[model samples]
Target: MTTLFELFSRQHVYMQEESAPGFAPACLMRVNPDDWGRIAEAARTENCRWVAAWGEDRGDELSVNACFEKEGAYAIARTGVPRAKPVLPSHSPYYAAADRPERHIRDMFGIAFTGHPDTRRWTRHQAWKEGEHPLRREFPADGHPPVPTAPDEHYPFLHAQGGGVYEIPVGPVHAGIIEPGHFRFQAVGETILNLEERLGYTHKGIEKIAEGRDAMALARLAGRVSGDSTVAHAWAACQAMEKAAGMEIPERAEFLRAIMAERERIANHLGDIGAICNDVSFTFAFYQFGRLREVWQRVNHEAYGHRFMMDCIIPGGVTSDMGDQVTVAMEKQITFLRTELEGLYNIIDDLPSLEDRLDTTGYLNPDTARAFGALGYVGRASGMAFDVRKDSPYAPYNRFSMEVPVYQQGDVATRVKVRAEEILASCFLMEKLIDELPAGQIRRDWRIPPSGAEGLGFTEGFRGEIMTYVRFGDNGRIARFFPRDPSWLTWPTLEKCIRDNIVPDFPVCNKSINGSYSGHDL
Candidate 1:
């Protein structure tokens, strides 16, 4: 298998180069700015997908990078904007996934994506003054006066002028203890005509805090980007840091990281499957899955330090170490889990009502899934065979044998089944890692390399592939760090999936395809 770096190196040598201000490789290939349009066309033609688009502030300017992926590799296309006027073309017309990130960059850096469908504010609020951009280096966080709020303005959505069309607006503050995000549903009675999501009410400016921070500190912040994804994000950030520092983790440490990651996956999947069932009014499934998830998290806290395993991953290696005794206990737990899972599957499969609620609800057809660039169960359910652990094969994943489960239904049922199968698969994989149990030190000192080198890291988080790119400053601080959560892709798919579904089924559909609000808000 070839490394992403190797692929980029080959492409760099063959492609034409052009310079942009404040960017590392001033002379990057100058595809026609319209080339973005062409690239989108090619991805559709060749059956590929867009992942993310984010900007890194370079003091004097901003450099935006958009990534697209195929089966074996991915390409990052860069577009630079001068610090004076951070403006660029919009790809939302072609790929719907570009909508949020472009809005986010606009919110944080004041960069504008011209021709974007909706050019409204995302993360910025009345906290900052009219001329202020909180994330910019020039904007100070100290002693700022509270700004006045503008009179509420109407959000103009696309017109659905049919006789039966009506609008339904749901929460910025929810009934449950979830994050704030508004969902605007345009529907004809029960059937949805269109869905527009408004998120970023909880934006924490994680990227702003990341600037100038040391690698070790950044790992802590990265882990907290989304509490549920603590292990994955931290692992990605650490992988990038280790690469930039020219350090390799010990073989034993790598295996431990993988173990932590697989465990994280199991915990989340169990909770989600149960929650989805609850949304469909399947109390038995919900209770069983919730009880199982509680056990899973409790085990994590017992073995590691936190229930969510927050701070369990560090720059050089994992913070928690599993001894033989813990390994034995885990083996026994796995045995019990496997048997319980089989029984649960039999129960779920026997219920025709459960299948009816899930089988075709919130369906994202294959073409739509590809165009929207969905990942994880959303993509896998639509017949996309992309799994970072299987395709990219990072850390101990490369050391083990595995299979990526996929289905072609692209509905709520398919998503649930994919998650369930993956949980079982991860249990088996973790057992293998624990059984072979490498004997060695689990932690090592990471040396910070002299400045100017950049590093890229990718991990298959429980949700999907989470990516981080970092370029170190002259003082070994983070000059530029961009982390893309899988939610960036999955969120757009949610909007697409809700189309044509009954208004009442929105709860089950939304739960089945749960995208992180906090992670995306960052």
Candidate 2:
């Protein structure tokens, strides 16, 4: 296997490792815009995972940054195009995960990614005019009054050519209170021939609002990036800011962050397991799991004052600390949760209806999962073994034993099993963390970084790898902030997995995957 460093150096890519102010070292490659395609392809050929890709308008020119991970380290490939031209080749041909993001860049920054297949507008469907690029610094944060969005029905979708072929168009607005997204399915009779999605209905102009905000403001906004993944996003944002500021948080804070993260993970998994079962009309597990989740959230509210732990993580450290009473109470809850979860699993494991609904439904092969860059439970179930906690160790995560439950089945059942196992693992880990809760200040005083300082935050959210990039400007303001949620990568893979399955099974498959619309929309 060729190391990413050796591969890039072999091609004389003009790359050098730049140490982040207080975090991991990142290899920064300076390449011509024309050569970006070739270098990006080479990186992918060497088995590198695409972490994120974004574009920034820099006065006279536009700069594009592509981040990749290999062997527990990160490398950034960068290039610039003339502002007037703003054109560069796309990396989507080599890395599928780059497709949507590149299109988003084209929509927002007017940076044309040449050679991109299916270059139709994504993320910006009538949100702006043809030539208007929202993230170009000049666009007002609060744009002109909202205009009625044109009907998105004209968007081209692949047609299934056959006598029995028909198209089923699901919601950009659903009956349930879930976030809006359009899903198009081409099917022959009951069997699905294809699945395609058009997301971004909930785009909140997050990246636009992030500009010029201070560290605390940025962290607060990051928590709202995706409601369910709030803790993960805030922590990642703060990590990047702290690194840029050269700030160090206390050991106790790191442990507390981990505990909060694990709790978040467990809560989501429990809800998902129930929801997936309920999609098959197995309301028993749904009620039981919902009960458990309610109790869990009550505790979160009592202990952290937030049901989802929002705003708990801040730059330089956490916002608060836990007392011995909370620790003892949390331990008791964990013990009870473990006993209840085991009993529930035993019954669920014996149910034939669940087995039928889950066993081989919505199968996403390992090869497909790998190509699509699936993450967290979705990737682990399909045998794509990559977990940020284990592979890219950070803080207290590196200090603990991380057991990533992997299953090769690649079906709804396998995904559910992985979630269940993870919940159990989180329970045990939480117990360990509380038992060994060290004594130290939860936060540390810190100074903001000078202009041009940059850092990146990588964390394993419940959904999977989340990357938050931060750069400070003059007067402690943010120059650029990009939070790449794992949902961006996982959502595309949903289309591939649903093929050949019947239309009725779609809900169960979707619930099992449960990619975040808001997370991906941003």
Candidate 3:
């Protein structure tokens, strides 16, 4: 559990351009260029996981930053390349989760990861030309030249076949009101041998859309990244911006933000547990949980001004203020939710069929969970207790009591139990926050962060750890903003978890480990 600075200071590794910023206690370690592989190897051996990667545009160059963290230590590795030739070493060989984001950066900024396994276009559609990158400073947003005629072609997909090993292609479009992402399954009979995911079809060009936006506008965009995680995402984005710009927020604002975040957690987990029950055809559990979730979100809208609390968090502080009336109402709702959840848990735990169906199904070993850098409930369910709020405390979370639940079962049933436990924990936290709600202003003036400086914000969202990496330019505009949604790691875990499970049971397993396609695509 040694810090990155200590590891370098102890000469276990070499570091360059190290800076200790006065604001937040973070070690700005500049990774030496030639030793990337060695560093990657050491990071893996030391259990350090990849945090995120982002590229900031200079006049003629792109500055790429790859960040890694373990315990409480964070290291940011910087590399730059000419705008004309944006190429760098790929970390896919070392970290499996690096593949999608690497490909995404390539698609957005035309940055190339030389050894990336799958180099096909990720987010670029027919809107842009071959060499054009949307995130580049000079890239035009409107009135581009007409695209030349290239014959319409089908997307190339990996094929698998060996007698019983056949392919099953699922949706880019599904039957339900869900986001689009294609799933290619290679299975032997009902047992999945391999699964390849094709995501990003719903890419809203959020980064592209956020250009030239003010801090408030950016907060709205951040909340919309994944609708279910509005509070956490907006809070995280503002946390980074507020820290970077040296803004001070009121204590009341911080507490309100935490309450909103915890409520979001409770609602999402309730929905997930219900959905998992529905997936397993347990009608009673599904209906009961769904009713509770519906009531919960309604209370959120009434108390927070938005159903999802979108734009509730801004740069300097929170946008929404909670009065005593709303606080009292929330406590009442929480009381009802606690009673309902206890009853539901009692019934669910007593159902032998439900227990048998979920137990040992869709297992993800601890090693695989850590190797993939899984986060949140899924990670916690598999013995990875890396909650950003607790592991890397921020704002109101630091002032409050927190307990992160962990389970070592690493199966569908274990994931369910962990999520249920988290739901109860969130209720306790929300109640405490309401009771001890501070009194003060909710918003403060915000200034743009100075140029050429980088900072990362991490939050424990309803799903897991949501990491945002940002770098500002001289013009007081964002040079690069890379958000690493927990969905990216968790989605792959689903593929691994479905291995020995039957095709019919896939629905239950999938629902239990739901990962957002839109969030990951971004």
Badly placed stretches (over 4 Å) of model 1 are: 1-48, 125-131, 141-153
lDDT for model 3: 0.78
- Candidate number with greatest lDDT: 2
lDDT of each: 0.78, 0.88, 0.78
Candidate 2 Cα outliers beyond 4 Å, as residue runs: 1-3, 11-23
- Candidate 3 lDDT over 376-395, as tens digits, reads 88999999998878877887
| Candidate 1 lDDT by residue in tens digits, 57-102 | 6678777777666664766666566788777778787788787788
lDDT order, best first, reads 2, 1, 3
lDDT, residue 331, candidate 1:
87
Q: Give Cα distance to truth, residue 160, candidate 3, Å.
A: 2.1
- For candidate 2, lDDT tens digit of each residue in 292-345? 999998899988999999999988789879997888889999989999998999
Compared with the true structure, model 3 gives a TM-score of 0.93
